[model samples]
Target: MQDLEIIASAGASFRPGDIPPPPDGGIEAWTQVAMGWIVIFATWGYVNSFGSFQAHYTSTLPQSPFQISWIGSIQVWFTFFGSAFSGRLLDAGFWIPTFLVGAGLQLIGIFMMSLSTSYWHLMITQGVVTGIGGGIIFAPSLALVATYFEKRRGIAIGLVTTGNSLGGTVYPLVVRALLPSIGMPWTARVLGFINLAGFILVAIFMRPRLPPRQTGPIIDWSAFRDTLYVSYVGGLFFFVWSVYYTFYYLASFGQQEVGMSFADSSLITTIINAVGLPTRVLIPVLADRIGPLNTIAPAALCVAIVAYTWVAVHDVAGVYIFSIFYGIASGAFQSLMPTGVASITTRLDTIGSKSHWGSYLGCAVEYTLRGAIGARESFEGWLEGKD
Candidate 1:
């Protein structure tokens, strides 16, 4: 009892050398993975379901599809951009406090979104506030889980990432089933309750394993010096730049281009997310053997090929087939991304910091560029129709 008390009290003061190595497997370590699953499910999983919101908002709100997409884009931008700060906090042994603040902001954003009546209101609450909240907690939780396993880190991250698929699948269903019956405010409230419950569990159970890495700059300027790291991050930037295009716009495409009803279009988002479930888990197991880098390179190539095929999809049957293929390809890449980052990071303690830098560069920097591309694509399609 006294020993447990001492460890708990030592938060933020103990040096990295005093801490033990990752146990790699145990009830406690696996429990962190479980908690991480909840975190990912609530954060990225919810983000993945934005297509549902996009389609709904396009109809009910006075915003153009391009304008409505900014809500989701800014949400993603905040989540990715804020990771650098929050992740450093994790390394500094501020995990509990950081998580509490983040979770609180997230819940507030969601509940407030229920009352928002206009585009700017939704942008503030759903896009900025909620994105900030999720950003604070997301990378830290995954970094924490990464610290629990070395050999199995790939599979561990893989399992936790399955939350992305399930959350994406479930949230849309919730919106589809309840939006017409209960209305948008109630639907948003329900999502809030679900996130609130999961966060409570995460707070109670997820404990950080490493003592604070007491001395290091948060930015880790040294990582930029590594040749392999820079190259990998450069590739990741392009992938993140374009990868979300389908997840965010596929449903809108179904309605406008494929001539599907809103309900069926929403299902397109769900199918894309759901089909990812198996690949996200299984591909990491393969990555564990061959190396995360090797596994991810091929997976990324597959995702690109599948995305290019999107231009050819013109009918309802083609849409379904495209969604399934893209979901599997993207899921495999998504599950491996963080694991790949962890593999390259030499020091276990810097995992959070490095992962944050990678994500910030990949997701945040890519967002604005991707948004411009989306706008240009929409305009070109409009002009083609005129011809």
Candidate 2:
């Protein structure tokens, strides 16, 4: 009890007026910023890298493509669902414990996945375990970044999101290179070790500037009543739906419609991530200068445009061009989402509302899954017409 008081006092010291102005080029400030990025990178990278695993699972398990996608979909579901539980835990000042729990689950999940020979094994290990772990890590990391930066929030979030882009680019290539040599089981174990190290660094260094008690409850349910807040959430749902649909299906579309080799289709995915990396950085910087919504609305419109263009383009070069433009637009939407949400709330204290995060993101993922299903059905219908 006494120890809790001491921790509470330390947290109280970080109140807006109490914190000293940041030092110019201060090592500590930069270090904190780096920690934020590292956490984001590790969590999102693991999440985005699902494609590599999904492809391998479908091929090895002899399941339909849709069944393989369920592995990722369930993973995404738990990632969002657990956010509500973890967010409140974070608000209570349990950041390190929360991160540690997430890291442990992720490691266990990876190991489980390494040993699995059945579909149910993959679902339990990857979908339930890793998804829950990702949720635990993601909520606190995002909340902590909010604690660290006020003026530079947009840019800071942008930098962190770039980690996801990097993971998307690198993870597929790594899996491709290793699958034939080390094989899936050993490869899973090796990547698990890498994730363990990254997450440990995050747990140790990713302390919130304002301690949990000072931040209030972890779950801020009242955020739902705000009209603008609802809009922000809705926008995020549509954005994620459109983006993930494109991410998961574009390669398959190219391979089937454009008659590209599997290797060429994979290159298109790389191109998307490559274009996304710079836009992730550039868009948020621009958002910080203009209003976040000012930047976001236009980008969302562009994504809609690109979605239709992707549907029309059946040639390799056209798909490549779509990948670049769509990737940039998607990156901009993602980089600005949290900033836009943060803007709608009057008190920053309520920003970590766990239920809202879960519902908003879960809805997005759900809609994305629906979009992918619909696109697949459409493609099959088109093929039937050609026959």
Q: Which candidate has the top score in TM-score?
A: 1
Write the residue-wise lDDT of candidate 1 on 1-387 in tens digits: 334223322321224565566888999999999999999999999999999999899789976777788888888889887777788889989999999999999899999999999999999999999999999999999999988887788899999999999999999999999999999999999999999999999999999998898799887889889776676677787788778778888888888777888899999889999999999999999987777877888999999999888778889999899999999999999999888778777676887887756556667766666555545546336324331
lDDT of 2 by residue, 44-84 (tens): 66666665565555456776656666777777778777775
On lDDT, the leading prediction is 1
Q: List per-prediction Cα lDDT, in the order shown.
A: 0.86, 0.68
Candidate 2 Cα errors over 4 Å, as ranges: 1-25, 214-218, 354-378, 382-387
What does the lDDT read for residue 9 in candidate 2?
Answer: 26
lDDT of 2 at 85: 72
